[model samples]
Target: MDEEYDVIVLGTGLKECILSGLLSVDGLKVLHMDRNDYYGGESTSLSLVQLWKRFRSNDKPPELLGSSREYNVDMIPKFMMANGTLVRVLIRTGVTKYLNFKAVDGSFVYNNGKIYKVPATDVEALKSTLMGLFEKRRARKFFIYVQDYEDDDPKSHEGLDLNKVTTRDVISKYGLEDNTVDFIGHALALHRDDSYLDEPAIYTVKRMKLYAESLARFQGGSPYIYPLYGLGELPQGFARLSAVYGGTYMLNKPECKVEFDTDGKAYGVTSEGETAKCKKVVCDPSYLPDKVKKVGRVARAICIMSHPIPNTNDSHSVQIILPQKQLGRRSDMYVFCCSYAHNVAPKGKYIAFVSTEAETDHPETELKPGIDLLGPVDETFFDIYDRYEPANHDEHDNCFISTSYDPTTHFESTVQDVISMYKKITGKELDLSVDLSAASAAGEDA
Candidate 1:
């Protein structure tokens, strides 16, 4: 227990495991510990029996739903953007070698009591049914302008500086309808709310470009991808990467407590009356509650069904974003669905999730707009969890705490936390210069 290391990671969640892997690869002696016996701490994929045990207590799942072992339900369901930072991290760390990824099937947005495929590209905008003939031409021109705009090319700026203008200004210049702007901002740009309209247009423009490039990468139905088994495979893969780089791991270690020195800086971790010395500590919010502040609550409904979500072009896996304007809410609601084609369920079963930032006390009522879209759910579970962010700086306390997962069904914000923590710890930004096309090919082959 007296063995000293460079960093002591106190949880095996996706964020912690990723840091463990990256730090170990940098030749830092790392010690990873978890109280649970499993690899993923909070973001684990569970079997049908485990899911029932967590939610239903002694109630057993219906046998007609299929064998318990055939299901892998994710606790926090999210998909990875094909060209997002998370995928770049995987490629840079070579974790892609440990997992296989399949493109998601569809991406849709809800507007005016109906769902429509988001017009992400110029062609899609021209053919979109969400707008009128004249509106479609306007949207197509807007899409072309965005597609051709380049940060370094002055001629492509279209006489407006995105950095100086707000997203609202750009949309207004094109005279796009309110509904067209809704899907482009909320669905394509992946904004959780309409707040981005008041912010700099450059941020939204870059995000939209990322979505288009990601969609073009696979030339598939959507811009996102999911692992073969589930997201639970992610932490395990990074754990293995850490192990290969000489990092030590301990699971089922009870009472794992962070030890602070007299100066209030994290020094080590103690478990079972034995302390492992370290210079710094990295952990999830649960390990050091006092260091984090509750920012919001996320309400989620997990559903089991016999078919794919209706009106999604029969997509076996899909992501649907319900803009707040359409639902008369302050934030967007997300619907994610996956079926046997993704290997997360049995031959004829599907798993779907509806989630959003909880704005009211009644989660069921808040999520009804998305729930109503699902035709028939065989079984469902609803929950609300508090979201937290670090109130203390890691540089001052040497305790790097990861934020709680948000309601969005994507890894963009999650990876931003990780990248931010990495910079704080190492005093440098992570360099991710890997070839994404090659990495995607390798992951597909795996």
Candidate 2:
């Protein structure tokens, strides 16, 4: 390595990317790298920044821009797709838009397994998607104080309720069908990565309400914003910004070891056989010790891609599915069904995110640990279809499954943990032992 940086960011998570860019934008010589080939640690996308810029530049007059008058409705609409009963309600409430708020027609199959459309712009859909803590108590005082945000008004003091509500309480009080509860609970699990019963519903609601209020304020009407390309856009865009500030963005450069000079500071970062030198290091891939200790487990998701796209249209919709009969205190399974970010599949194909508990307790030394894959917390994945029907496609063959495990939860066993999740979800046999440990060994080569 020829250069020395004033600052070096340990992880390339979007947050770190933002910090790197901000520092670089402030005229600091920064070096940002990930321990993986991928740049975005948790947030990954192929073409996020470009798409976001285009979405932002769009000048089409928004039909409805929430309650705010000065915000741009164009980007907000893209968050919603165009389908679903819940989605329709959101549009009526001025919470959803067409472009920004797309819908995935098949979410929950209830009543007659009928197809249902989820509106992309629907505030309710996003609300249900995010605040799984609302225990059927509509119009609760759920507002948060964001230092002076308008929605922080005491009159809209709904967010304060999160301090008291548990996710379990919200699921029961809302009177949602078991399947719906499971689906929403599954989302909460994915976001928080633990038992829904463990998370405080009020806290979830408060966080959501805070974002929603921010959205309403920024976009004028709806408070939903998706990456122009996909969730991947945020990190990619920040990478671009990092480049402008003299930061180096290296894809596939997995960090093998941190060689500290005689001084305790990290003087060199080894990737494969190469190394880079820097002074200050900001470790941000996984949360630092202080952050992860509070949240003990990791969350894992299996992204399923099937050939022959389904009828759903919305981009930012989520379906929660739980078992009809309670499995212990929670449902049997929790599935978040949605179309992959626009254009993710080759067309005629669809993607859904299946959430389940990670092998958080498993030891890394075990070659292959077994995991019990639970179905959509409800009856079947297609169960939600009874309520809302979706577009048709070919058979359920030609599916690709991808899984992600939070490293903080399964620090030493991150890769193995992900592999175990995949096997449980897809029922396919895998030998990730080579891939897992080899990755660590290969990091030395990086």
| Candidate number of the best TM-score | 1
Clashes of each: 0, 87
List model 2 lDDT by residue over 1-446, tens digit each. Answer: 55787666656654455456555655778777666776666444433222224333544322221111211111101132111112222222222221232222233311123223321123345464323455323212212122232334555443445446676665455455554444343322223323555676754553343334333333322222232234444445556776856777765665545556563445656778877776555554242222222222323333333322233233233443333233331223333333333434333333344333333343221101101222222111110100111111101211111122332210122323323423432356432122222222211211
Number of clashing residue pairs, candidate 1: 0
- Stretches off by above 4 angstroms in model 1 are 443-446
Q: What is the TM-score of candidate 2?
A: 0.46
Output the number of the lDDT-best candidate: 1
Distance (Å) between predicted and true CA of 95, model 2?
Answer: 24
Off by over 4 Å in 2: 10-16, 34-38, 41-205, 211-225, 251-256, 270-275, 283-317, 321-334, 338-341, 359-446
TM-score of 1: 0.98
